[model samples]
Target chain A: MIYLRLFWEFFKTGLFAVGGGMATLPFLYDISDRTGWFTHSQLADMVAVSESTPGPIGVNMATYVGFLTGGQAGGMAAGVLGAAVATIGLVTPSIIVILMISAFLQRFRDNRYVNGAFYGLRPASTGMILAAGVLVVKAAFLPDGLSAFDWRLPVLAAVLLALTNLVKPTKKLHPIVFIFASAAVGILLELSQ
Target chain B: MKELLSLFSTFAKVGVMTFGGGYAMLPILQREVVENKGWATEEELADYFAIGQCTPGVIAVNTATFIGRKQSGIAGGIAATLGIVFPSLVIISLLAGVITQFSELTWVKNAFAGIRVCVCVLIFNAVWKLGQKSVVDRWTAGIFAIVAAGAILTKISPVAFVLFAAVCGIVLQTLLKKGGVGQ
Candidate 1:
C-alpha cells in the first residue's frame, strides 16, 4: 500500500510537473502539504540536495523522498516509476497528436484562438513561478511562519536578488558564489549577534 | 565498469555545478560529452536534448540516461541515472531529518535565506530565458501564454499545461504548415 502510495504521489508529480525540474517545485510543495511526508524545512533541504546533486533536481528530490518514505527500494521505485509514468504521460499525448495530425502541423500552428490562449498562459506561468519564489522565501527566511515575518528575512532576500543581478552577463558563474556569499553574510550576522 | 563510472561522474558534475537544471545543462553537457570526452557528437547531443525535452524526469537525467543507453544500453542508463541521483539521496538523507534544528542556528538560517533568494532569482532568470526560447512566433507565443496562464489560474495540473501546450503548438504548427506557416 505504501509502495502504491509512493508511486501514485510521484506519478502525479511527474505527470503534472510540465515545465521540467523546477516546475516540480509546485507539485512537491503540494505533496508536502498533503502528506506529512516531509516538512517545509525538509523541502528546502531537498532543494539544496537536489540542486547540489548530479541528476535532475526533480528526480533527485523524488528519490530522496522515496528513500525517506520506504528506503532504498522505495526510492528507486519512486524515482524510476514516477519518471517512467511521468515521461510517458508527457510524451504520449503529444506524440499521438503529432503523428495523427502530421499532415496539418503547420497550419495548426497559427490559429488565432490558440495564440490568445498562450498569451494568457505566459503571465500565468510567470505568476506560478513567482508564487513558488514567495513560498520558498517563507520557508527559507521565516521558518517561524509568515505572520511572524522578520525584517532580516526580506532584507536578505533583497540583498540576494540584487546580488543575483550582479552575476549578469556572466550567468555561467558557479552557483557556489551565491551560496558562499549568502553563507558568509549569514555567518557574519551570527557572530555580530 | 569504467565507462559506467564516467557516465555517472560526468552527470554528477553537471548536477552539482549547475544552478539551473534542464536547458541549463545543454552547454555543459556539450562541453563534457562532446568536447571533453568523445562520448557523443554534437548532433547526437542535439538529438538527446530533443528526446530529453520530449521525455521526462529532468532534462539532465533523461539526457544522462539516453547517453548512457547509447553508450552501453540498459546498464548504461541505470548507471548514468544512478550517478545523477546519488548526490541528492546522500545530501537529503543527512539534512532532512534535522533541518529545522539547523535553521534555528542564526547564521545558518540567514545563509539559507540568502540562498533561497538567490535560487528565486535563478529560477526567474532561467524561466525568462526558456520563455524566450519557447515563444518563437505568434502561435508559439500564444501557446506559451495559454499554458502559463492555465498553470497559474486553474488548479489544472502542471503536466496538463505542458501536454496541452504541446498539443496546441503541434496543432498550430500543423495548421500553419498547411497554410504555409512552416514555410
Candidate 2:
C-alpha cells in the first residue's frame, strides 16, 4: 500500500510540475501537507542534500522521500523498492513525453508555429522557476511565517558568495566546495551559540 | 548492442556529474555527447535543451532521452533515461538510510538548517541565470511577470499556465512575424 501510494503521489507530481526539478517543490510541499510522509523541515533537508549531491534534484527528492516513507514500513529492502518505484513514477512522464517529442519533432523542427510555441514557453518556464525560487526562500527562511530573527541577511550573503564565483579565481571551484563550506559554517555557528 | 551499452554508460556518467539540476549539467553534456562522442552538435543540443525545458519533466532526463533516441531508437531512449536516473536512485537510497537515522542529532540538524539557507541562494541563482537566457524582450518580460503572479495568486494548475503560455507564444509570435518585428 505504501509503495502504491508512493508511486501514485509522485506520478501525479511528475505529470504536472512543469519546467524542471525546482518546479516540483510546490507539489512536494503539497504531498507533505496531505500525506504526512514527511515534514516541511524534512523537505528543506531534501533540497539541501539533493542540491549537494549528484543527479537531478527532482529525481533525488523522489528517491529520498520514497526511502523515508518506505523505510518506516518494512526495512532496507522495502526502502530500496520504494525508491525505485517513486523514482520511476517521477520520470515516467518525462520518458513518455520526450519519446513523443522525439518521434514528431523532426518534421516540425523548423516550423515557425513550433518555434513560436517555444518562444512563449521559454519565458513562462522562467517565470515558473522564479516562482519556485520564491517558494524555496519562504520554506527555508520563514517556515513559520514572519519571526523575530530574520534569516534574510545570511541568505543575501550566500547569494553574493555564490555569485562571486562567477568573477575570478573562485569561479573554477566545484559547487560541492560551497556546499561543504556552508555546512561547516553552520556547524560552527550552532556550536558557538 | 554495444552502442546501447555506450549510450547507457554515457548518460550514467552525465547523471553522476550533474549537481543542482539540468542547467548545471549543460557543460558536461556538451563535453560528453557533443565534443567527445559526436552524438549531437552543439546547436542540436541547444535545441534539445529548449524543447526539454518546455516539456513536462526534468530537463536533464529529457535531454538524455533526446540524445539517446537520436543515436539509436526508443530502446536507446529508455536506456538513457534509466541510466540518468540510476545514480540518483542509488545515492538517495543510501543517504536516506543514514539521514533518517541521524537527522535528530544536534550537529546534523544544524547542518541541514545551514544547507537550507544556502539552497535558497542556489535556487535564486538558477532563476537569475535562466531569466537572462529566457526573458529576451518586452513580450517575454510580460509573460514572465504574468505567469509568476498568476502562479502565486491563483489555484490554477501549473500545467494550465504552461499551456496558456504556449498559446500566447503562438499568437504573439505569429503576429510579430506578420508584422516583421524580428524578421
iRMSD for each candidate structure, in the order shown? 7.6, 4.5
Interface RMSD of 1: 7.6
TM-score of chain B of 2: 0.64
Alpha-carbon RMSD to native, per candidate: 8.5, 5.5
| Residues A142-190 of candidate 1: C-alpha lDDT, one tens digit per residue | 6566576667656766766565556465444545566567657666665
Measured by lDDT, the strongest candidate is: 2
State each candidate's clash count.
34, 0
User: Candidate 2 residues A1-193, lDDT tens each?
Assistant: 8888999999889888776888899999999999999899998988767756779998889989988888888899988998999988998888899889888877687898888877887787767656655665665566555654555436644554555446677655544455556567668776212
TM-score of chain A of 2: 0.61
Candidate 2 structure quality by residue, lDDT tens digits, B31-89: 57876899986546645655665678888888888988988999999888889999998
Cα lDDT for residue B167, candidate 2? 89
Question: Which of the numbered candidates is closest to the native, going by highest DockQ?
Answer: 2
